[model samples]
Target: MMSDCPVVSTKLGKVSGFALAKAKCPEAQQVYGYLAIPFAKPPVGNLRFKPPQSADAWKGTRDGTKYPPGPMQSTRYVEIFAKYVANYRVADENPRYFDEDCLYLNLFTPKTSNKAKLPVLIWFYGGGFSAGSSVGYHGQTICGLQDVVLVVPQYRLNAFGFISFGKNSSCPGNMGLLDQKMAMEWTRDNILAFGGDPNNVTLFGRGSGGISVSSHVLSPMSRGLFHRAISCSGVANCNLVTKENNDVSTGFLLKELGIMDRDPEIILAKLRSLSAKALMEAQEISAEYHENPLQKLDDFVTVVDGKFLSKHPRDLITDGNFAPVPFIIGCNNTEFCGVLADRFPKGFVTGEIGEKQAMDLTKIAWQVADNIPSNKLDEGVGLVKKEMMRYISPDDRYKWSKLPTNVMLDTLILLPGVEQAIAHSDAGNPTYMYYMTQQLRMHHNRAFSKDMTKKPEFCEADHIDDEVFTFGVPFGNGPVAKEMKFTEDEKNLSKQWMSFICNFAKTGNPNTPMSLTNWTSFKRDDQRHLVVKMPLEEGVDLMGERFEFWQNLRAKMATT
Candidate 1:
């Protein structure tokens, strides 16, 4: 008999988890879900600079009723980064809850009947190099809908995770990655107790989360940590720097604190003495780093410490020697729309036809951070939006061409998606690609619902659209748009996604019994994607004419 509610006693304590829904796994008995359990000792205060230590065993039955607090994030709403970039909102009253000690993971498990081991999927939330959390994200929805277990963890970000201290053992800026590794190690040790199979684990994420999965793919320390890897929307770019490039950004932040920093130990001690507000205040000086050349706020990146992650992520991917595991990866069609909108509001996205000034430098804020090769910088600066333009047809160009927003989706996002998918495929890894154009608009450009008659300008699948379906966190509190009217087509799309994912999880083949041609694996030289247009069919080239034009232009630029 399939059970809905099940209980498990963990090392920390006895806990109860209720399976919100039922789905058969390799073998199904009963299932339960638990949210917000500490996988490691929180990395706050003195523990901030140190690697993730073990979780101290608990004395009482711990409750996993709700998600734990998210990590110390930006000075804005929980989804401020998304709202700011995507021009959409996914916020709730979940006050931007943060703390350096934030280290939590949510779990969903099928009630196992003896030795039936189910594969696990660990989702890593991504928000540029800036902000994100696992809280409120739906782990149970996916797990219950499909028969796989789901786990999502929260890690430090920005200054906390990316703080660099040059070449010093005392500095552990990459503690964020260490936090993820610790959680994986924790799962290896404890997931079994929750009726999960530790041996078969897949690390997946979208956007920055995708980059995190890529990080693990390339990290030597991350080997054997996961069996399957999937990265969505976040490309090979936008990852951490190598060891040789670790700048003294933490020391600079300390200098902002009016302290002549000595070493990581001294800096951390001094930092710990300061209140959290004060620390955030110091990080604010990055505004100066944004404008000035000298006196730049030091770096805050995943330290390429020889001990932890041994190389820059791109190097590993290029060598065709990443964690040789089953791989699935792709990007969103409109990943850069919101961000480009933020940069060039109105129709400013159109570039110069002959002069070198047609593009907006601010459009690609991420690639500009590194002292990119002057040429690459120029290319990246214009490339994001230019590629977006490539996706619209000649007829549509007249409608969206003049205005930057029209082409923002295709150029900034889809182009990058194709680029990353090609890289993974060329690397001899089994890969998949997707172009999600399902823009969820409640009204005419308004985030919330509007009059029934009005249409929306921001109508295509903007950035982070894919994330919402992947993590089924419904709004129970705070403000949320009334786009809750998911059409039957949308629901069918979601169902297809769920079916495909579950199939992938079970056998590495996304093929459903019903040949849903809407989603297919890409072949080399076949620059096409599962055009997630309303009909959501899969077959061949989409926006082909524009794609060819953009490819030629991009190729022309690459040579120079």
Candidate 2:
């Protein structure tokens, strides 16, 4: 099960990575790990905004026992930074990391068997479009037992990765997506040497990574890059910025950057040329931009760029543009309650600043969207803003749960799951859905604030609860994280997820004799949900009546 060879090699040289878990650590002695490994040449200097090129050949052996720093970091989340460094460990002498010259990936195999080409599972980390790395509290045992190739690639993010230069062919954006495409192509060509089956690849990601994977599944440019898809705890939403299209979104950015006139080409060119630090500093002016995930999402995301991405990923999925491959997509039980604990004072049932007032605020909020027809923009951005305000800011934060809870109940939990379920059902793909109800032995209140904590009767299946179990990495080494080891129930859940994923990778269908009992596929007519509940019972429906009401509201929104 252990191998002393690097999974990938090129002209530069043969870098060797050892199986730390299976070879060194007795606790994880059964798990095989290939640490920091390169997939493409470093993107720096002249190659900064360009596509990935080959790295120079190395004459001697390269030691890839550690992960390279990825992209950049911000100062706000000190705790998060500590966790990141801890996960992406480095030698003691070199502490400061985070660079653009990180085009490496780490692939962990349970065992190296040349006789059989094992299934490959590629992972994408989450950090909106701003920041995140492939190394974190990710689990290694499942890959070892499941006998698959676990590939984790480090892609570009934020201004360093996605900002474009006014449609200039030379100044291309979306470098992050390009890097990912190259990694997949690398897997296709070289995975065999690592004892992995190139043809049977499943793209899996959470949060930002989920959105990225979904975009790949829906984009024509990403066709054939991967065979199956799994998007967790993320949406498939995106908006393109332009003079005519994003005046409101751009106006705020321009005002913050001290630009009076809304010049897409001139200002964008100057902004693109600015140092990464300068760009990061200036971007801080628009607080809304940083708070929202989309603004900083890799400088290069799915756009209406005629070449790589012709249309938005969501629209494509809605229009039945899926690859007919198997689909397993789900979101956390609660999403927005992440850092800004839920505190909705009013009922999301009605916007605090009503639709009319929101329309007025929209004019101020969006500085650059002067060209968008008022009625059209109001119907679009304005409406979304009004709804968001209601969800994010409640009239009260303590001793009560109003709009925040209602929004979580109505939108975050149910909508994304049911939508994708219906989409997969229409395409006749076997889509197995999941609801993460298992609360951490600790942090039940920390996630959504003690005030907004659910009743003991009502379990917290909060936004990040799944990450703990899914990755086998503790979020905060709290007493619960340290003491509350995975019990038989948690192990069963993990095994169930593995069974579904492994079977799906092995065959097109994930249905098996040991499937969760009564868990049903999405039915457009019946509208039944196989709610995953405590004690892990199936057919335990969620807030079914409220969900149906919300679903109808969504249908009505589309028609109007």
Candidate 3:
């Protein structure tokens, strides 16, 4: 009989965890879960906008069964998008369920002796660093499948997390990243008690979470914390990750909140006094004032603070100053298709957006992707359109309608990911790359099928498609699983995908234990990358023409 509860003793105190239900991890005999383990003290009161403090020692056994409240954030946009656009359910983020003092982690480990020393995988969730929770991603399946320990850590979000008041102020930037660093430190110190090998840990995340993983690789403060890194869809060099003029944004925020003080100390004090809801509201309002299109995507994001990040990630990587760890980086084939579909619903459904509308949207996309000056905007748009038209005929209305999405795929996600991989490989670090082309069953575009009664055969994979399979969602009982009806082949594919991830975490190479295809390591000379889908074929020079077009265009733009 399984024990009603499993107890583990840590440096702080003893804690009790519950056994995972059999349905959650069907293959394993038992898996233990310890939820809501406090890694840092509450960042409230005077500690707001400050680095996380170590958790205080507790006297008695603490209950680690119930989930802690999610980090404070405004979930209105994400909630609407998930429900209406994606036709999917998101983790509940009820206002009452969010709290400012949300610095906790959830851990799952297979049944083993304390000395098992299994590999550790820490997940940093993605929500543009403004909204997300550790509640939805259950670790039971991964832990049970691979004899590994999975941990999900929660960090501060929105204004409370990334708001910076410039240098030498009471509030420096990247408190959210500092929260992640602290959680990593906590895992390093205490994971041994949970049968995990701290020295052999892997940090993996998607979207903004992926950016966090890549940021840690470049951060001097994060060295020696983890052995390997995996960034699924976002990288530090992408347009989404920016070192914006935070002073302007900070000023907007303070002015919105009726605090127009220029003094950092005064600003900090006033911000600390406001309620969490009020600060979040101010962040939402101030975000509208940002003219930079990239900042609109993520106003509160990772910055090159002198302490956490001394220089730009590109310069650091080129100078060989980043952590020398094995890396795996990739993105979905058409990462922005769903975004484009939602943005222009009629165009996608009708499959005819007309040439004028396509060109206009493409111009806007070019502005966002390349930051072309107003005088040179038309020139840049013409260059992009010329190259895009080379692949598709001028009269093909259906393909023309989707031109902007294609531009975003290359300029925003694919190009950045490939550049990072080449840089990492050139810097003498082992690097692996993948291009996820397999369309997920729960893909948002499926909802837009002309025949709503029948399932749509969408071919392109959108953003976060890789994440669904990476977490074994198809086989688990999460909200995503409830919506997706997986076939036997897809379930097997998920199992295979999880094996590759686990194998990488365990040995720093994905093709360990066994693999259907020999996964090749990425090299600058050949630019080899795996085309991840059914059968898993190895491909060389992924998007060679498109990558060259963007690279040459960027070079030309830089010179001009």
Pick by lDDT: which candidate is best? 3
- The CA lDDT of each predicted structure is 0.58, 0.55, 0.76
Range of the 10 consecutive residues with the lowest summed lDDT in candidate 3 = 84-93
- Give Cα distance to truth, residue 209, candidate 2, Å: 0.9
Native-referenced Cα lDDT, model 2: 0.55
Top candidate, metric TM-score? 3
Taking all chains together, each candidate's TM-score versus the true structure is 0.79, 0.75, 0.92
Better of 1 and 3 by lDDT: 3
Candidate 1 lDDT over residue span 1-560, tens digit each: 11345556666765655454332123223346676678888777677767788877776666666657677656542443434321112122253666776787878776543265777888888665466787545544466556677888888776777676654557646777888988898788777777678888888887667767877877778899888787776644332223344455554566667887666567667877877666766776642554322112123556567666555554555566567665666555545445333333344333212222224333333233333345575555565455554544545423342334433333434444454556677766666666677765432344334422222244466556676556432211223333344445655566566666666766666677774563566655775556664577664554455556656654565576
Local accuracy of candidate 2 as per-residue lDDT tens digits, 1-560: 22554444533456566553431113332444555667778876556667677555666667666667766544443233332122212122122366767788777765555546888888887665566776553335556446677888888865456555434345445677777888888778767767788889998887667767766776677778688887776545433221112233345556677777445456656565666666555544453554333243322344444445554544666888766777776655544333323222232212332444334434322322122343554455534444545434454332122333334434543555566667867787766556665654444433333322232222355544565555433222211212333345655565566656676777755556887744455455655444444455554344455546555544544566
**Which consecutive 10 residues in model 2 have the weakest lDDT in total?**
474-483
TM-score for predicted model 2 compared with the true structure: 0.75
